[model samples]
Target chain A: MQWWTLFQKELIENVRNVKWVWVPLVMILLAVMDPLTNYYLPQIIDAAGGMPDDTEIQLPEYQPADVVMMSLGQFSSMGVLVIALMSMGVISGERKSGVSELILVKPVSYLNYITAKWASLALLTLVAFSLGMLASWYYINLLFGALSFGALLQVLLFYGLWLLLIVSISIFYNTLVKTPGLVAFLTIATVMLMGLVTTIFSHILEWSPNRISTYIQQMLTTGSVPSDLTGAAIVTLMMIVFLIFGSVYTFRKKELAS
Target chain B: MALVTVEKLSKKYDSSPAVSQTSFQLTSGKCVALIGPNGAGKTTTLRMLSGLLKPTSGTIAFAGMSQNSDIRNSIGYLPQHPVFFKWMTGKEFLVYVSRLAYLSKPEALRRAKNLLERVGLAESANRRISKYSGGMKQRLGIAQAMIHQPMLLMLDEPVSSLDPIGRRDVLTLMEELKEDMTILFSTHILGDADEVSDEVLLMHEGKIIESGSMGELRQKYQTAKIKLGFDGDLRDYQEKVTALPTVIECYIQRDVLHVTVQNMTAARHDILTAASSEEWPLTSFAVNRASLEDMFMKAVNS
Candidate 1:
């Protein structure tokens, strides 16, 4: 019951701040922009008018699945950053402003507090990502061709987990830091470092959460599940659980010192 | 009856202690003031009691509660500088807090409305908290703290940041509140403590120096002195006042003659008789009772 109240407060704060509106708007724009730009690439070049008049530019016919993957590519970079920045202040800002001090004084448990935050942000991210992906899928069918609905659901499931990993990482860092900017910096840095390591050591780090994006792309295009897909998904789920527990532990120890 | 008993409650930061071996009790229906200077650990003590900070080594046991049970259910705390959800309206904020205390939605709304009216914020209940002035915010803070109707309401410097009008508003509200539940509030201003508190805990340098009822503290530190002021000069009347049989010591400080007396009643009669007979130009005469400031200074110094 206490967790429900805290979650409602978090949701209301996001709604009041219009985070619900802008985050999904940005996601939709990123998603739709991919298909629209890909479909109009030749005309865009013609409109640019910078190419030689006699030169002919040949472009490949993009597949709907490829366009969806392209949108996911945009999401993994810009969309992940957006989600990270949105959740950067979840815990740190309340501690700095002294609101946490007042709230924690009640009969609320530390686990409830941390879990409420994680659940609220997770719901927002999943909802926004789902809306963005569904919109992109619709556009992909209309512009290029029809992709299997099963593929879209699979992409949403795996890709949403990766995005949630960003939210979880952001929340964990928020509990560990007192400054929102520092939290944002640390969260983004962690994600980028993981991506770098996963790229350089793909074979050894096959179970890495960062590889979920690659497995997702493969799943969408070839309709073949990677052998390490289950491993990556399991590791990602374990990391999310560990982060939520770690956040609760850190928050209990810190106790809103400011 | 004692409602809360805290024993050896100490909080240490890294190497330095913010509160050390402090034990105190809150009597039911009494407003207790935790009085101390800045950096005296009053805030730390209140935070521990509210369960916002863990004590370094101590046990806080409330009446009728089990050893390991959560004491926060009976406590409502307002931090020294309370920051609320500025985007929330006053009524919405109170309702939110009430629900956190586990009140049902309709019950929370009813309590929120009643508290807003009680705190005199009913007219502005729908306004966003960002639009509230400092005093309005303080009142709203008090209202939220009381929404759950906890057994004890703890406020850390509830009025320290308010202007005069705001201070009076909070003080008056506290005075009314102490008639029911126990209230333990901290303040550096001795005057505010003197005005509203029934008992006082004087703290200094991370330790409680004195704790007692307000009257008990005043009597413990009482100097039994009489202050005399004159129109022209104190030198003329100082010698005469000192020669009185009941006067023990007489000294001039800041244009007033401070006369410590053996007996207050006899001293008053003797000094007034001399002033009337000698026709000395008397400006003011006051029988000095020990103020909270005097008790605080004596306790801290001792």
Candidate 2:
């Protein structure tokens, strides 16, 4: 009940700050804009490039699944960056603002506090990302042909797991670092490095948590789950669990000086 | 009668001690002031007692609870600069902290209203905390601390940041609150301690130098001296005053005679009688009593 109350406060804070409105707007804009711009790229190019007579420009046809994949790509880079920046101050901001001192001095459990934070961020991530992807799906079906809804759903489930991983990385770093700026920098840098390292070593690193990203795109493009999806999903799930516990453990020390 | 007992309580940051082996006991329903200069570890000791900071060593047993037993539910703490969610209304913030203190929602709401009224903020309960003045914020801080009706209410410099009027408002509040719960507050100003505290824990250099009731402390350290100002040559009365059996020593400086006396009652009688009989020109006579500041200076200097 206490954790629920605290979680309610977090959600109210998100509402008051307009994070609920603005974050999903940014995400949906990133998702749908990619497809709309791609569909009109030829016209945009022809207008900009005023050829003297007849100029033939060859542009590749965009499939609905491919455009959705392109939107996911934008999410992977820009969406992940936005999530990292937005959630970077989850723990550190409270500590710096001295609100944690007021609450922690009560008989509240450190684990419950951490879980409440993670759960709220997870809810926000789920809502915003789902709405953003649905908007992107609408535009893709409208401009490009209709894609498989079942495929999009499966891809969202996997990619939602991936977004969960990113949000956990953010909160986990929030617990470790005191400055929100440092938390954002470190979380995005670590996630990007994990993505880079996993791509270079995918042949050997089948179990890397970063593989969930590729699994997300692969699941979206092809209608079948990859054979290695179970191993990567398990590894990523274990990491999320570890990050939650790690957050709880590290957050215990935050009140030592606060 | 001891509500809180702390023994050898110490807290260190890195290798340097902030509160060094401090021991003290707070009697039930007594307002105990932790008085010290800046960097004297009063804040550190209060933080450890309130469970905001863990002590590097020592024990704090509240209401006879053993070490390691959680005393958070029984103690209320207001930090030196109490921080609140600026977005929350005063009543809402109180309700929120009351819930954290384990009150049910309905009970929290009731107590939130009750406390806001008690703190004289019922009219402004719906105003956001960002709009509260320094004094109002401190009052709201105290209301939140007391929402659960804890046995001990700990305030860290509750009035240190307020304007004169704000300071008076909080001090008056503290004076009324001590009737219900034990209050352990910290301040560098000895005058505030003298005004509201029944007992004082005086700290210097992170160590407790003196701890006693206000009356007992004054009795122990009170100086027996009198100041005499004369209209005539002050030297004329110095010798005559020192000759009295109660007069232990006498000296004149700047037209005033300072006399150390063995007894105030006896000295007052002898000096007045001699002045009347001898027709000595005596202008004023006053017996000096040592103040908390004097005692603090004496302790710090020693």
Candidate 3:
């Protein structure tokens, strides 16, 4: 019961701060720019370039699925950055300002606090990513060709799980870091570093959470899901669960000095 | 029966101790003051009792609870400087806190409104906490603490940061609150402890130096002393007064002569005779009563 109440508080905080509205708009903007840019690149280049008149540049024929993949890639980079910025202060700011001392002294459980934070961030991720993807899908279909909505939804779900992993890690870091800015830096650094490492060893680390990004792209471009989809997803979900529980455990023993 | 019994409670940050092995108990329906100077561990002790910070080694047994049981539901705590979500209105924050204490939504709303009225914040209930004055925010902090109607209320330096009016407002609120609930508040000001507390606990250097009712503390530390003031420097008379047989020692404290003596009756006679005979320009003279400052100093030195 208290969990539900605290979750509501989290949602209210997000809405009052306008993150619920602005974050999705940012995501939609990033997603929309992908297909629009790819569709008009050659023409835009010809207009902007002070190049010699007779030079003919060859460009590959673009596909709707490729446009979808480009937008997912945009979501992976800029989209995750936005998620990190939005949720970084969820716990650390309260601790620094002494508000956590006021709330934690009540009969509320630390698990409820962490769970509330994770649920709110997850909700934000779902709403923002869903809106952004739907817009991207519409643009890709118009600019390139008709693509399977079913496959688009599948890839979005897979990539959404990956975003869930990032949000969980961010929340876990929020408890450990002392400042919001540092939490943002650390979370983004960890995500980018993990993405680099896993991509470099893509075959050997088949079950790494970062593979979801590649798997989403592969599923869209080839019209077939990755063979390691289920295994990598199970690993990612397990990691998210572990991070949430770990955050709860750490917050329970945390000494709130402020 | 005692409402709370704490034994050998100690907390160490890194290796250095902030609160040492301190033990005390509180009976039901009593207002106790934890008194000390800066860096005296008053805040640390209160934090431990409120369960906001874990002790390195100790046992705290609240009434009807086991030694290690969670007693947070029965305790309300306000830190030295209470912080709130600036984005929340005073009423909304109170309601949210009440809900966290397990009140249903309607009940939470009812209690939040009631507490706002009780704290004299009803007029500004809808005002954002960011715009609240220091005193209003403090009153709201207390309202949130009392939202659950806990058995015990713990406040750390409730009025230390307020203006005179703000301090008076919080102190008056505390006076009214102690009538219904047991309260243990910490303060560095001895007068604040003397103002409303039924019992006073003096702490220094991370240890409890003395604990008693205000009357008992005064009686225990009472002495036969005389105070004298003159138009001239009082230090000139310190030597003359010390030479008298009944006078044990003499010192000057802010233009007043404090003469500690063996016997009040005899010392008064000898001092008065010398003042008249020597034609000293005396301004005021009287036998002195024990002050909380004097007692606190003695306790700290001892």
Could you say which candidate leads in DockQ? 3
Sorted on DockQ, best first, the list reads 3, 1, 2
Per-prediction share of native contacts kept: 0.83, 0.59, 0.84
- What interface RMSD does candidate 1 have? 1.3
What TM-score does candidate 1 reach? 0.95
Q: Runs in model 3 with CA error above 4 Å?
A: A46-51, A222-224, B233-236, B273-280
Cα error, residue B52 of model 3, in Å, equals: 1.7
lDDT of 3: 0.88
- Candidate 1 chain A least-lDDT 10 residues: A249-258
lDDT of 1: 0.88
Candidate 1's docking class is medium
Query: What interface Cα RMSD is found for model 2?
Result: 1.5
After superposition, the stretches of candidate 1 with alpha carbons farther than 4 Å from their true spots are B235-254, B273-279
The parts of candidate 2 lying over 4 Å away from their true place are A47-52, B228-260, B269-283
Give the range where candidate 2 chain B is weakest over 10 consecutive residues by summed lDDT. Answer: B232-241
**lDDT: the better of candidates 1 and 2:** 1
Candidate 2 lDDT score relative to the true structure: 0.86
lDDT of 3 by residue, A1-34 (tens): 8999899999999999999999999989988997
Better of 1 and 2 by DockQ: 1
